[model samples]
Target: MDVDEERQRSLKRSLLCLCAAELVMMVNTTAFNVALPNIAESLGAGMAEQQWIVSSYNLVFAAVVLLAGFMGDRLGHLRTMIAGLGMFVVASAIGLAAGNVPVLLVSRSIMGAGAGVVIPMGQALLGILFRGPALSRAMTAWAIAGTLGVPFGPLVGGALTATLGWRGIFGFDGVVFLAVIAVIRMNVPRTGGSRKSRSLHVPWASVAMMFAGFTLFSAGLVNAQHGVLTAGAWMPMAVGAALITGFVLHDRASRNPLMELGLMRDPSFAACAPALMMLNFSMYGIIFIMPAYLETVLRHGALIGGMLLMPLVVASIAGARMNDRIVSRIGPRGTSLLALGCLAAGMLTIGAAMWWPDGMMRQSTVLVGQLMAGLGLGAGQPAMLTWAMGRVPIGQSGAGSSLLTVFRQFGSIIGVGIFGSIQSGLYTAEFHDLAQSAGLAPQSAGSVTLDFQRAADMTGMTGDLMRQAASRAYESAMTGSFAAAAAVIAATLGVVALISRRTPR
Candidate 1:
């Protein structure tokens, strides 16, 4: 083979390896949610601890991910990825050995740090690796890796938790990281920094503000379960908002901002922000709530819940593969509108499913909704990202990719938090009335309410009457949450409609 052919083969191998690592990163992120229940039981964790367990990683991930992309740009994508993999491996090992909630939370936060670095670097590197049609295909695979991770996470987590216990999930992650590291070392080519990269200074003030803002915002949102008026629910959010505002002002003034603030000037890039946010808001919102819904209302086991969720993952992968052709034929705007419509329809379907008393009907309807939502997100996200990137210069792909990733992650943070609050609020209100009508004493009612407070786990409700009430309350709460998601999708569709076709392709 000629030297050019040899180099092409190596690049393909490297892309595959990087994609594999990306897949594993997603698996680890999503699988942890499935394992949370098991971890709570094993470690005797409280409701607050469980919330932290899940949100810590996300909080940390969102805080540092932007910086990770800059590191990839300045240092090297491959080197950053390797560092992330090594950190992930160590973090997983720590999680496997964790004897308490704090240790596990620390481990998860560390893992998120690694994943934050890895995720943006992977996307940045992919931009560097391919061009034109090849870039489209590579991004399709990348999108598949991401969307596949969401549903597959529960599947893998359920299987691992059922068979080898929750620790097995962490152990599996460690193994995946190790294998990916080997592939990275063998296949990926080294990339040098740009000449102008050294002149670019890291905006430490903006970084701190961004990190503090997200962390506090997350803390506040997670605390919303306490009640919207409570200090836990609003104070941190207030502080976070202020910090984020400060960051925006600082970024506007900086000579070399962390991300290209000017990208929003392009209509296509501007649209991608909320468009991707809404996509993830719908997708992750459901993923956040479904495991509990499956186990509680439908009374499915973890493994079975995972199996039922498989159609979503499978459909997402199919949608991503089909998107390239669809966009080419229908144009980007048409494809986007259709995807948004599908998402709105899916949310409505799921909401309707919640009202059904019959198990078979509810499951089937939910399955259909899952498929629709997955396909919509799978198609819409890749198109939005591609469109946004087209507007970006090749030199700034890392920053561009980072901004996109942060938008998605930000959406996830808000989606999960908002949905959880909706469910918890609705469930609490409904359950109280149900419990009172059931003629339980105030003390008994309080205990039962506390048991179902998180709205994620129904294990504590023992008697048939309590279980029945819990299920009914859960179903109602989920319906309200789904309706909220549908509204978000509809609103996003309206925003997408405003983007003119005259924008650069």
Candidate 2:
């Protein structure tokens, strides 16, 4: 074979390794959802703690990723990736040994920082290796790898948690990343230490502003569980909004903005970006809500909960397979409307299922809804993604992509934070009333309300009352959360419908 052919084969191997690394990152993001209940049981975590343990990572990741591209450019993509992987390996070790909630949260945030660095650098490396047709194909592989983690994450997480316990999730990430790092050292061709680019500008102020804004914003929303009227809830929210506004103004005024804000001026992009955001919101919300419900409320084991999500998984893949053909028939606009409708319908159905008998009927309804929702998002999401990206000017595609990612990641944060706050509030109100009606003492009911596993383990009439109230409260809260997801999807549908006519075919 010619030298070029051998080079091509080696590049493909490198691509595989890089994509595998990314898949590990994505899986770690959602896999913890299945383990949240276990974590809570082990650590005595409340609603806020549970949400932050997950959101802390996302908040840092979303905030850091914008700046990570610059880091890659400065440090050299390969070198930056190695450093990030090393941090991830160390953070995962910390997570494995975490004895309490605060420590675990700190560990997750560090992991998020590593992921923020690794992902963009991984993409940068791909850009270096593949050009023209190969570049597009390589990116498509990268995108697919990221997508697969969402549906399969719970299953993988569930299996790990069941077999090796919750810490296994962290252990798995650490082990894989270490192996990937080793492979990169051995197989990936190294250029010299990467040099900083002369033309590139790093917006340190914008980075700090954006990061602070999101953190404050998400913190405020999560704090709303205490009551939106409280100082804790509204104060940070006000400041966060101010900071975010400042971020935008700063970006607009800056000569070298962190992102291409003008991409939204195109009607298609304006509509498509939020559609992607809402899609992210929907995905994050469901994964966050479901696992704890299945594991704690319904008394299903982690493995069973993971297995239960398979229909949604299978259907989503099928929907994705059909995305292109549907777009061919109805166009991207029509395709998105259909997908959002199905997504909303599924969420509503899940809400409705709680009213049914708590045995097979409830389970079947949720499963059916999962299939419907899964198919909708699966079929619809790629179309929206394609539509949004297609509208970007070739010259500005990188910045456009970054801005879209920021929107999508924030959407995930909003989903987790807002829904978490809402769920906490609903559960508290419902449990309070139920506890009062049962004549239970405030302290016992408070403990039960804080964590479902405690109620499951208690004894006697009080235990029975606690169990029932906890279960009922969780169900009620979940119902409300699903309803909110449906409402968001509905609003997104309205927005998209308004723009569909204006959207370029």
Candidate 3:
């Protein structure tokens, strides 16, 4: 074979290895969701603690991504990725050994940090390896791996948890990491010396401001679900707003800023960022609540719940692959609008399913809605990523991609915390009312409430009273979540429309 042909073959192999590494990272993120109840049961965790298991990982992941992106640029993507894989392997092992909630959470946070490093670096390497149509094809594959991981994680993790137990998921992750390490060592070519080490001087003030702002924004949304009207919630939200404002100003002023403010100013990035966040917010909100609705309200097992939800992931992979062709034909704006419409329609369909009379037919309706919703999400994601990153300078692709991932993570955090709180509050109130109506004694009513709460906590419940109450409450919560998601999608449509109008297509 010719030398150029050999080089091309080598590059393709490296990109595939990078994609494998990224898939491992993505699996770790969602694998824990299906295992949340099992983790809580084994650790004797409360709702707040279990929530932390998910949220803390996202919190650290989102917070460190910008920094990690810069490090990838300065430290050489290959070197940084190897280091990240090492951290991930260690973190997974620690999580496997964790005997308590705090230890598990700490492990998750470390894992998130490792992920934050690995993802952007892998994307950066891909960007460096391919160009033009080749670049697009490489990215299309990358996006598919990512989209597949979210849904596939739970399906596999559910099976693993049932068979080998929750801890086994971590062991699986460890094995995956070891395999990736071997691939990286063998296939990934060394791209010579690192760029001059960028000074490790983080803008402490800006970092503080960003965290405060995100925390406040998340807290406010969380409080809103509980009907809590307090200054504490609103205060942080306001403070967060001010902090973000200051952060932008600081970025503009800094000689070597952590993030490029100019990137945010790009029309494509600005428009696509919010749209991406909304897409994830809606997608995760559905993922978070739907399983509970299926298992507890419909009396399905973990296997069945996972199986019924398969359409979302399956359609997402299809949509992402199709997005490349769709973008070429319709352009980003038109394609995004069409995709968002599909998403809104899917959510509405799910809401309608809830309103339907309970029976096998309602279950079928819900399943159909989930399939449509998955299609919408899958279609939207790749187009959004392409539009956002395509507009940025090639050198800054790592930073831009990291920003997209960070916003998506933040959206997940916001979605789960807000939606979970809403579902919990509504379920608790409805269960209490139903128990009283059933003429149970006060003590019995309390016991019923406790059982309902346990079901919510476990993400499943089945009993005559518990089922009736849980069905009513879960239906209400799911409907509300869908409505909110629809509103967000509508807003995204407006944003993308404005962008299409201003920018020459």
Candidate 4:
């Protein structure tokens, strides 16, 4: 009956709506992984094209999010979010109607732009609504909504693709975002974009430099898998490194930098970026590879592969729900260290499973590893967000949150591009050798190695043998990839240790 209570209730509703909108964005990100095989099949995409399908969105998102964050601060969160959601709807329409690979990629990139704008403002709105304990709880809810999309994304995508078809997937996103726009218009309070002069400092140069740097770097990594020593691989990498250096120098010289480069000077906020990067590197890296492995190498349907990921998804949800409680009890440092340890253990376990000779047992081992990895990331990630954002000035919440997203997306690009390339290369080499040893001609064996369905077409007892050989090769490659990931995770653990020691008890 009181105005204050009524205001509080309305704010909560707005937060819930924003969380829901964010969930839609997160779902669009990973849901497409399950759909990639179907999309590739429909569009006749190759390995590089398939990887690009996933990476293109991430690359654009990472590059542009910082600008969006700054814009949200200057332009007003609600208004910026509406613009982003509108872009999402248009992109979804493009995706729904896309008849070829190039068009689909362009559509995905535009969707990434929308997401880059919307997501940071979602976090900024939470910062606007709550602080301290309430802030902690709000973040957990927001993170859970986003995290839910990760594990369940495949299942939702799989079912949609199987039942309604891949086009329906984009159709669903378009419909939800349209509804979200209506909700925002009706529910969210509006304010002017800027209280100060509207001539805000927008760093167009930084955007160009960062985008070029990440693009070249990722392209180089993808090329490395196929041609490790080629100019195509190393030259781009060198150029990328140079561009990134230029970006840092350029950003530092800017009167109002796109991101607070000074934030890295603070130990806790600094560590969070790398920690977030590795968390995604470990999480999305495996996720990027799994569907293809299950569908192509194991000859399972996309639905089955999606279903198999349920344990990982379930465990992640459980972990994210428990995050606030864990942080409350053990503190952020302890919580982060625990999560990092879980990630390392999980990756190592997956590596072991990949090394296992028995196929059935390997699947079980992978499931267990997924559980550990999911829980680790789900719990630790919120803590990183909490700790990092807690240090940010409230006025710049959008910028801070967007920087965090940039790091995460950057990691995703690295994880998918590099890991996929490595897995593909290793599998190619092993499958080629095995096919020749099976008495097949090198050319025929080479052709089969190039195409997944052809490998499946080998029939009867010989076909079974060939399939088994290919599976072993894939497993070996996957194990190697997991092991490498585990090493990266271990380094992440070291970073957590530094934060843990400095964090107050």
> In terms of lDDT, which candidate is strongest?
4
Model 4: per-residue Cα lDDT over 1-505, one tens digit each: 8999998888888878988887888777777888887887787776778788888888888887888887888889889989999988999999998999999999999998898888888887777777887788888888788888777788888888888888888998989899989987888776435649544868899989999998998888888777778998899989998998899899889887787677777777777887888777876787788887777677677778788878877887888899988988988777877888888889889878977777789888998999999898789877878888888877777778888888888889888877887777777787777768877533223212345555556667776666666667777888887888888788877966776566575
Sort the predicted structures by lDDT, highest score first: 4, 1, 2, 3
Q: Give the C-alpha lDDT of model 4.
A: 0.80
In order, the Cα lDDT scores of the candidates are: 0.78, 0.78, 0.71, 0.80
- For model 2, the superposed segments whose C-alpha errors exceed 4 Å read 1-15, 72-83, 120-143, 182-201, 391-398, 442-451
lDDT of 1 by residue, 1-505 (tens): 9999998898789878877887888788777777665675577664456666777777787777888777777777778779988999999899999998889989989987897788878877877887777777787888888888878898999899889999999899889899989988898887745746455477788889999998898888878876888998899999998998888888888886777778788888887787887876776677777777775456676777777788888888888989998999886677777788888888989999988878789878988998898889789867777777767776777778888878877887888788877776777788777766776431222212334443334344435556667778778888898998898889878987786456643
**Candidate closer to the true structure by lDDT (higher is better), 1 or 4:** 4
Clashes of each: 0, 0, 1, 1
Local accuracy of candidate 3 as per-residue lDDT tens digits, 1-505: 9999999999889978987887777667766776765565577664456556776776777777777776666666778778888877898899889998888988888887788778877777776777666777777777778777777777877787888888889899888898998899899976522465456565667667676666666666555544546775566666766876787688779887878668877777787777777676766677666755654456564556666677778888888778878879988777777888888788877877777775777777777877777777777776777677677665676677678777777777777777666666565566567656764321222212235445454433234555566467667666776776677677777876786666546
TM-score of each: 0.93, 0.88, 0.90, 0.94
All candidates: CA RMSD (Å) = 3.0, 3.3, 3.4, 2.2
Instruction: Tell me the tens digit of each residue's lDDT in model 2 across 1-505.
Output: 9999999889988888887887777788878888887787788777788888878987987887766654555455677778888988999999999999988998999997887777756765665666554664565566556666776888899999999999999999888889989988776665322344323668889989989998998889899987989999999989998998999999889987776678878888778777777777888888988887887777788988888887877877778777767877898788888888998999899888888865799989999999998888677666776666666654444455556667777888998987788878888888878778888643332223344555556677767787787788778887887898899889988987887677655
Ten-residue stretch with the least lDDT total in model 4: 441-450
